[model samples]
Target: MKKYILLIFLAAGITMTISCRKYPVDEKGLLITDNTTCYMSSFNLLGSDNQTVLVTIPTFANGLIDTVKGTVTATAKFGTNITKVKPYCSLGANDMLVDPFMGQWTDFTQPKTFTLISGTRKIKKVYTITVTVQQ
Candidate 1:
């Protein structure tokens, strides 16, 4: 008799705990998961033709994407106009930049900050891009 009572109480406790779990849902009732990875893998400036505008004469000049410092630095070609250049980058599958909209003309003569974010958790990372014209 005592064993039966203990068994019933244990089953009830298990069911109550199991039914109490709740997962976050989006507006459409879809489950929201955390994917906390928001960083730029590659960063580059492009010209009107969608090609890199950095100098590559004597040596290739690729933009530095410093994940540690969260900064991007590049040197444009000698004749390239920094005021009318575009930027391209590589990000994680679930990471996207939220500020300073991408795929548009941006003046890079001065340092600019671009904020990247991850899905669900909205983890953000700011990257400063500084471009200088090669003399």
Candidate 2:
């Protein structure tokens, strides 16, 4: 009877291990299993001085871009002026994210805010972007 009980416990442990599988998650902490798609895959600023300016887009451990702190900062070169700033972003399938300063022509005048909407779940994520001119 003891041998049989031991065998049963081993079998149960194997079953539990098999059942506990890890699923993919996005930066928003949303499970990527099924059709739950909510994240920014790509983000960038165009027409900026690529040589002298630095742009950084934060991301999550799961490789999803961080929407909450989706701040992208650009610093101009010495004596260089930032004439215009344009934002380009790519979201998940059916997911929608908008940048209030998108496609707007400016001289990096002020801070910009962005919002992202999840496709089916209707989740919203906000981000702030800023640009600075350094002499």
Top TM-score: which candidate number?
1
Q: In model 1, where is the ten-residue run with the lowest total lDDT?
A: 55-64
- Per-residue lDDT tens digits for candidate 1, residues 1-135, read 999999999999999999987767656575556677777877678888778898631111243667767787778888888899888777764434446677789998789998886656467788887888988
Task: List model 2 lDDT by residue over 1-135, tens digit each.
Answer: 999999999999999998997766667675544445556666555565443233354334433355455655545445544566555666666435454635555556677667765544456667665666665
lDDT (Cα atoms) of all candidates against the true structure = 0.74, 0.57
| RMSD (Cα, Å) of model 1 | 6.5
TM-score of 2: 0.48
Deviating ranges (above 4 Å) for candidate 2: 1-36, 48-70, 77-80, 99-101
